[model samples]
Target: MTNHRTGAAEQIAMRGLLGTLNDELGSPLAPEWERAFWAVPRHAFLPETVWLGDDLTTYARGTAPQTWLSTVYADAPLVTQINDGKDPGDGERWPSSSASAPSIVFRMLDLLRVHAGHRVLEIGTGTGWNAGLLAHRLGAENVTTIEVDPSLAIHAALALKHAGLEPRVISGDGAAGFPAGVPYDRIIATCSVRQVPRAWLEQTAPAGVILTPWETPWLCYGLLRLTVDGTGVASGWFSPHASFMLMRNQRTDLRIYRDVVRDEHVPAQSVTLLSPWAVTGDDWAAQFAVGLQTRTVWHTWHDNPGVDGVASRLWLAATDATSWAAVDWDGRTDERFTVWEYGPRRLWAEVEAAYAWWRQVGSPGPDRFGLTVAPHGQHTPWLDSPDQPVPSTG
Candidate 1:
């Protein structure tokens, strides 16, 4: 009787928490989605151990029940698996899988605009909560979820079963998609991808929507929703706020090394009146513009006083580690800053041209930008229509 009462209390608490989350999200969830949220408990899908806080401190449910319950219901994402289930000597580890934040999940679902009888294919079924929710609304038979990690797939399958739902859980690469479940009315990926795969476009039904987190080397993440046409092309606009962990195969590692530069080499030195902060700071619109124009380059910033009273420096490096540029900002009242570039590619020049193009085009935001994926997996970022492709900085 005591256990029954505890379960009942938890259900009530979960309902209340869901209500709060719904309100915070501006009540965007459909009535069916809300019902599904109440029916499918997120706590059941979470693992026994999770990482908490920025430091990735390990938290076990058995050791701290209150913290576990609180975190399980929180709107924030919970890191369930790290370093592909391997231990790091330090607590800090790369998060390979996570239960996405509830609000973002709902937002993605809303963008998907699925219907009651719609056949849905979900990629990256991290913890099965999303699958459970989809199953609750569209019936388990209408939902097919795929996870790359076999362990995660098994655990998600078990969790869905425990929740009294049975969505088809497949263990395979999400990029390839599931041809068995081809012609899905809607497809969604919980993970982020550098480029939408050709298989996704080929497998989706005509007029069906594909939603996923999209990223470029210049910008970490954005939400993309593309609608497939009969011509084997998909086009869509991006939302700035969405972010997610990169899909395993799409991850890139770039670091700085001195050997890439030669002592005999000399780079052209120049100064620009543009402030680095103006381009790299909170202005995501500019960043997106730069990202689409400049390929395979990322930027980092630092603050400190140099011998010439330079207060800040912005560094850019290529993913191949073959090119690098540094822009220095001194304490001078003037807007001009010093730039140094190495390697065959002049990265800073490309950035400046990109930023200039963005300004010339009226400084559009993510919504103003769109993506076009060709049948062969080539991606073309556009300003407004698919006809006007954004040119890359050469």
Candidate 2:
């Protein structure tokens, strides 16, 4: 499709999406915000295809105009990069860039409570769309975003420049907050973080807000809104459900499990006990449970021997190698898992406990939870209520 046609279609979609979002949010989204949404061409920042399959082979690409349009405004994420580090040639499953869905973006913005003049620091500069929107509201000079990947950082910077908006775009580790522009009025992270980084709290101004998706043991993601006290202490509630890629360094290490789990050790019992398909498709419940109990460590893969059907292998391990669980799947048959450990607690049992906790809470939505942060080395609880202190399980 021609650029004009694509832009026209995007405009229509944006108007409709904004209207729907406004109705759902029970308030009119700010006009300037709406204008920013309308003005940015989302597809310009996306790649030709996005992998939507369990494996890297399958994808949803922009082969046709309709296909591109459908993928662009479908209220779903479109991947822009895979395992080429910062390049796009490698046919891997890693996702480096994405046009985050409109609803999720709006949810984060709503949590941010960004006003006309709030100075904001965004953690992930994926497509530059988010930074553009913030720049529209707070003025270009007041927004600063940090991206870890140098190639992605350059692309995003060019994209923003093309859109005629300028924000202090830096290529650096977002985990280390942007210090040159310290004490921001608001800090919003577009990436998912296993732990709230200490730099964020330290850099936020007094009474400022820090909004990001907090990793949890539930099936859904939590949008945490924290209020900084200017003393490296912040507390607030988890306001919504959203997800993002884990911080670059915090990504799960799959080396050991990938090497250990082969065809010979495929357990027959876990075959039916766990669904391979369901497990691969973003099982936040299982992922978060394993993350909390094992300190953000896990590995999973499918077991396919010769011409026989497919089974799955799940290895839950800790950083210290103190605990591990090997669950196998043979089609749909049950396979008894061998839980091995010499740790303070059984990893699999903790996963089961977290799952049970979810059921006991009536499977509460992610929006109901919250996060509170104190400076690094300072212990504080992320409570469900302002008064109720959540005991540290770590």
Candidate 3:
């Protein structure tokens, strides 16, 4: 499709999207930001299509201008590239880049509390939409974005230029932050991270805010907002209901459940019982469970063939060993669990402890917990009383 036709449709979609966002977000974002959103044609930053599952055949792509605009504007995420540089084309198992869903983008923006004239640094410049919005609010000169992929960085630079904005686009590790743009008023990460990178805390200015999704052991994520204190520590709240892609460097562990857990080889009597659903449900409960019982990381997978035909498996692994449990939802709660835990701590116990903490707290939402970071380290605190700190680990 021609650029002109694509631009026109994007403009119309932007207006509609802005209206919906305004209603949903309730004034955290200013009206002027809408202009930047409309000006940047999202389709310009995307590939033709993307894979949705491990299977190469099941995917979504933009075949025409309208499809591109609709895909870009929809509340759903639009995959921009896959498999990093290895396989930019579709039919790949990996998803390297994407225009995050509109709602998630807006949610992060709202959490950042971006305002006119605030200097911002963005990590993971996927689609460059977040940077575009920041540029609209803070001006191109005041915004800088970094991406690890050289090709994706180039595409983002070209897309920003095509939109009539020229933010400094750097091709480097986002975890390192843009040192040249240090002392930023705000730093926002479009990616998920296992731990708060020391560079992000170092580069941020005193009183500046850093917002990113923190990956938990439960396979769930939370938005951590920290206020940097020129030295290296940041403290803030853990926003509720947030998740994102793990940082490229941190995306490890692709082992399947069957390989890790041993039901036949290991005796079932050695395994302890734990509720997988408790960890996969909502925040407070999940976090509580993870903190108390889970000494290690665990993940659950669910597959349903049809009504009453569901299979669920929970994979539990520690920094040292692996074990798992399986549950069949075929009208009977027939479940089997096995363990080969050789680590200092039991993984299943940790999972149960997290759930117990959730119940103890009466199941508080993620918003109730806050995060604080220092050059010394990062901590989660109760928002109501910032002085109280919650223990956080890598």
Candidate 4:
């Protein structure tokens, strides 16, 4: 199996992918970016064995060259690593890293508004494809990329070298950022973060852009693009919906049944008309609002837990695992749901207030919501404008 793409067929596939990306983006791909895309072909960075789709099924380039080539050239993400570099054979395989969908990749490139001779620092050098593109666009010496995983860093470095683009690739924690690259003209993170790292604020040049995917324990969605003021504070709006893997340094692993729920613990019981489905799924706007209001809260749903009458249940827990709540839907009624809350915080009640505030404030989407992070790392989420701070449920 050839590790590289060749011949006229590969060129046609690349052009097809660009057309698909253009249609999805609602604009023809930027001329400069189009050139970068062609030069840094995505398939070259991909491992011979790739994972595809939601289930992360296997697609080997050697066994199925045509299929692998088509999948690689599609406007979609290809899972490059799973289970944090573990084999995960016959076990639960969750995406640890992936090549981002082409549309969003191009979208973020445009969002950065990069200019000639701009020095860019990229966090999360997953496959080095992005770093190669940045190097090609802004020159290799002007781009620096950091990957937390040493193996990934090595692979990405090799791939970048293979592409004839040599950017500075370092293996280090992204949260600390690269102090040596202080006053970076632009800083971009290929990963999502629950909170904006203060180091990133410290390193960005005045009026420079810091673009990253955003996550709240409640949901994973939206990109945050902050503008530096050189005063240690950076304020940014949540734009375009996209979910990237959380930064490796900022990830939390907790299982509700094993780590949170306990049989001996008793919870306060209550009834609510608010359907669990209202804020849990599809209504990303509501979820984003709730996430902002309760910064540390996260959720998961269990369907048909074999708990007799309950058809489904939504479990909510603080990221610290200090407090927890559960809302049960009995299948028959959509209007009424039973709620249980334990620990110091009335988690469900906090949710109700957050939902109410979102409703009262015209139910703005992610784009209208923004965050103002002070130098000390306190996040003040706001509505429409920073002056209108959203109330927090203590």
Candidate 5:
């Protein structure tokens, strides 16, 4: 898969993509990165077959050349592999690796602030396009990327080679940052993480930056950038715009009926003015604020419970499956809804309190939040400043 712009058509496509990226980023790419962008075409790094959109529809370059080329230039993520590269059979399909959206790719690259001589360690080299771009800008010797899946790593390495770039692609777990590449000036994780790995902090140089997408059990959003001191601690603030898959090692595989609720359990019923939709609603800010506090709970919506007078129910359960709550919405009213609580801990009350706190504080967005990872790997999430720590459930 040699990389080249065939003729006028390919050059036109490249120009269109550049314009789209510039508009999305709200600024033109730095001259250096702009050169790298043209030097390494994104289509060269993608597989012959790529999945597009949420349904994972297949698009093959060999067959649908025009459609595939157009889709490649779109400002959207293309799923490269699903179910960790295994045939899901009849099971549900989930994205394991992808070529991240161009907008997000450039956004993160801009945030990195990589200089000419900076050594970078990138975790999760899914498609190798990012590594190729970085190598083209900062030289191949200054960048190293790791991928957990061997096949993906091999494919990415081959892709990088075809694109005339080499960045020392390593096949290993990203949680354990590569020891040989110690004191990296910039450490970035393409996948989101629940907890910052201790190795990442130890491997970074003094005043280096570690940028990774952040995830909590309650909500998976936000990009956290922490600046590491020469000491073991690192602290930074969160920014908007991220929805990457969780790191393979940090996934929680708990089902609502299979793992949480029991048939014999009798839940205590009550009433509350707080609506379930208010906390777990479409508002990402509210969900993000609640998630920072209720770190262990996940949710499910039961649209048709089959119970008469019960139009819908929102189920909330702790990650350990020890505590659970359900909020029932009748067809009539929004002022008060029925709440059910059944475990040692009251999950609904915690959510209500978390929501109240967020509202009391003017409902800050992701950017206003920050985290401090201590020397011993203790993460304390704060709002605005370190002294004002947000309430935690766990």
Candidate 6:
């Protein structure tokens, strides 16, 4: 089947997709963005094969054209590459690259607030669809996008070419922002990062916006929109419910029982009444608060841990492979929960303190907290204002 969207049926499908996206996103799309949406056809940028869900069922256009079309138009992320494009036929490997959900794509672009003639630098040129949109909106010559994966980059370049867009597409480390395109008015990253690279800040024009997904080991990712000051500082607050795949270079491999502990290790036992759910619940605000305090810890939940009664285990491990902790909760018990800690850092203790701080601050959400990236590469998380650092749990 031809990849080009030239047939009458394809045009109709594109229009229907636009209508659906408009309705789902609430009302008419932003005027400028709408034009770009119409100009850049998403179907043109998709790979012949894509993956869906944990099972990673391969959806190939040749076998199921209708399914392919539906998936392309849907408001969901499409995994374009898995296990860094080396998973072969196995679906067990982690997903590495994807076309971000359309809603988030537009949301991040809206946050960018690009003006006419403003130059833009986009990190992670996954499918080139995003670059095509930005190029359509603010002239192809004004947009520059870099992808780390060479194969993905080449594919994106070809796709952009097919779509009649000519934004600069380069293959290199996205963490090292393309300096040739320095002084950009806006910089956006499709991937998440643990630290906002110094190169990104240096490349951005003063007063320019740098938007990316910032993640802490303590919690999930948050969208950070920071404005660069000429004096070598960037400060911004996080938006709630924002997350993305971590940047390749910044991905961590810390895990408990596998990398952090040994069979001979012994943990101190303690019992506390602090309800497990309060800290490890669906409340993102609580999670973000805890993350800010415990900077380099990863956690996981194991439910029904082979116990007689229904019980849940919350495991915490340091990225450095130095400390680990576990909190076990049985549904019947409300007065106390079992906690085990090994290594120097008491993970549960830090979590309890962090949660307490979160409550003391009235359980503020991500928007209430801000981050200031200093010139000397120090990241100081603050509450409400830049000068007031959120009290440390350390």
Candidate with best TM-score: 4
Best by lDDT: 5
Task: Write candidate 4's Cα lDDT for 66-185 as tens digits.
Answer: 898898888888898998899878888899989898888889999999999899999999989999999999999999999999999999999888888999999999888898877798
What ranges in model 5 sit over 4 Å off? 1-6
TM-score: model 6 vs. ground truth: 0.94
**lDDT score, candidate 2, position 28:** 78
Question: Please, what's the RMSD in Å of model 3?
Answer: 4.4
Query: Which stretches of candidate 3 lie above 4 Å from their native place?
Result: 1-8, 27-29, 50-62, 88-92, 254-274, 282-296, 302-312, 319-331, 334-342, 378-394
Candidate 5, residues 38-150: lDDT per residue as tens digits? Answer: 98888878888899887889999889988988888888989989899999998999888888899899899999999999999999999899999899999999999999999
lDDT of 3 by residue, 1-394 (tens): 2243454566788667777777767663555655556655555566556544344333444345466556556666665666675744545366667667777787887779877778899999987778887787778999999999888888778778877789999999998888887788899999987678888888888889899977655654678888887567787776665567788887656464434644444423354454455566554546533542342465556566243444544455553344443433443453534433433455555555556655676666666766555575544445346775443331
Which lDDT value does model 1 have at 89? 75
Count residue pairs with overlapping backbones in model 2: 11
**Candidate 2 residue-wise lDDT, 1-394, digit = tens:** 2133345677776666677778766787777667777766565555556655345443444447666665666667666667745454544356655566777887678778888778899998987888988887788999999998887788788878877788999999999998999779999988776678888888889999888876532222556678988577788775547677667765655454454334444332211233333333465543443343334344444466332433555555555444445554545554443333324545455555555555665554444445566676343433357565433334
**True-structure lDDT of candidate 1:** 0.84
Residue 209 miss distance in model 4 (angstroms): 1.1
TM-score of each: 0.91, 0.78, 0.82, 0.98, 0.97, 0.94
Candidate number that wins on TM-score, 1 or 3:
1
lDDT by residue for model 6 over 142-211, one digit each (tens)?
Answer: 9999999999999999999988899999999998999997789999999988888988888889999999
Q: Give the TM-score (vs. native) of candidate 4.
A: 0.98
Superposed Cα deviation of residue 17, candidate 2 (Å): 3.8
Off by over 4 Å in 1: 1-9, 258-266, 302-312, 330-334
lDDT of each: 0.84, 0.64, 0.66, 0.89, 0.91, 0.86
Overall local distance difference test of candidate 4:
0.89
Ranking by lDDT: 5, 4, 6, 1, 3, 2
